[model samples]
Target: TSIRFCLDGDEPGRKAAAELMRKYYELGYEVEDCPPPAGYKDYNEWLVAAKLNLNRMNKRADEPVRA
Candidate 1:
């Protein structure tokens, strides 16, 4: 089984997710950090954006993003 870390896509949220992933990894568990896609913040934001069929950028939209 794999562990997934679903968290907010913000600075603090990312850090928290990383910490959780690390903790779980250290415990010998496979972990995945699954945050919402680049622009969205959380699951709610992702859902809202998906429903509206629009790109929703969070507050940190200016920050660098993953490819």
Candidate 2:
């Protein structure tokens, strides 16, 4: 089995993920670091950014194009 770490986006979060990855690696388990996107502190922040982008794209699609 593999472990995917969705930890926080701060230094401490990264440190914790590293420690856990090492531990699991030693145990022969696959480890994947799935931290939040850059500039985001957590998954919620990333989702907010994604939602904003989606809204912007939708708005653009709704607007009439000028020839």
Candidate 3:
């Protein structure tokens, strides 16, 4: 069985993730640590950025072609 943890991209988050991973490993469980992207501090920010990017792509796709 595997466990996934989504943590912030800051120091505290990193520390917590490390601690949790260590504990889980000691308990013989597979741990997967997921942190936000480089510029994002948390999952919500990353999600918002992703949504905006997707919207921009869709808008571009809807534009008419030019000669």
Question: What's the true lDDT of residue 30 in model 2?
Answer: 100
lDDT of 2 by residue, 1-67 (tens): 9999999999999999999999999999999999998899999989999999999999999999999
Instruction: Residues 1-67, candidate 3: write the lDDT tens digits.
Output: 8888789989999999999999998899999999888999999998999999999999999999999
TM-score per model over all chains: 0.72, 0.81, 0.87
lDDT of 1 by residue, 1-67 (tens): 6899889999999999999999999999999989989888898988986766534444357668889
Give the candidates in order of TM-score, highest first.
Answer: 3, 2, 1
Each candidate's number of clashing pairs is 0, 0, 0
| Minimal lDDT window, size 10, model 3 | 1-10
lDDT of 3: 0.93
- Rate residue 45 of model 3 by lDDT: 96
lDDT of 3 at 26: 89
Question: Relative to the unseen true structure, what is the C-alpha lDDT of residue 30 in candidate 3, on a scale of 0 to 100?
Answer: 99
Query: Considering summed lDDT, which 10 consecutive residues are worst modelled in model 2?
Result: 37-46
Query: Comparing 2 and 3 by lDDT, which wins?
Result: 2
Q: Local distance difference test, per candidate?
A: 0.86, 0.96, 0.93
Error of 1 at 6 (Å): 1.0
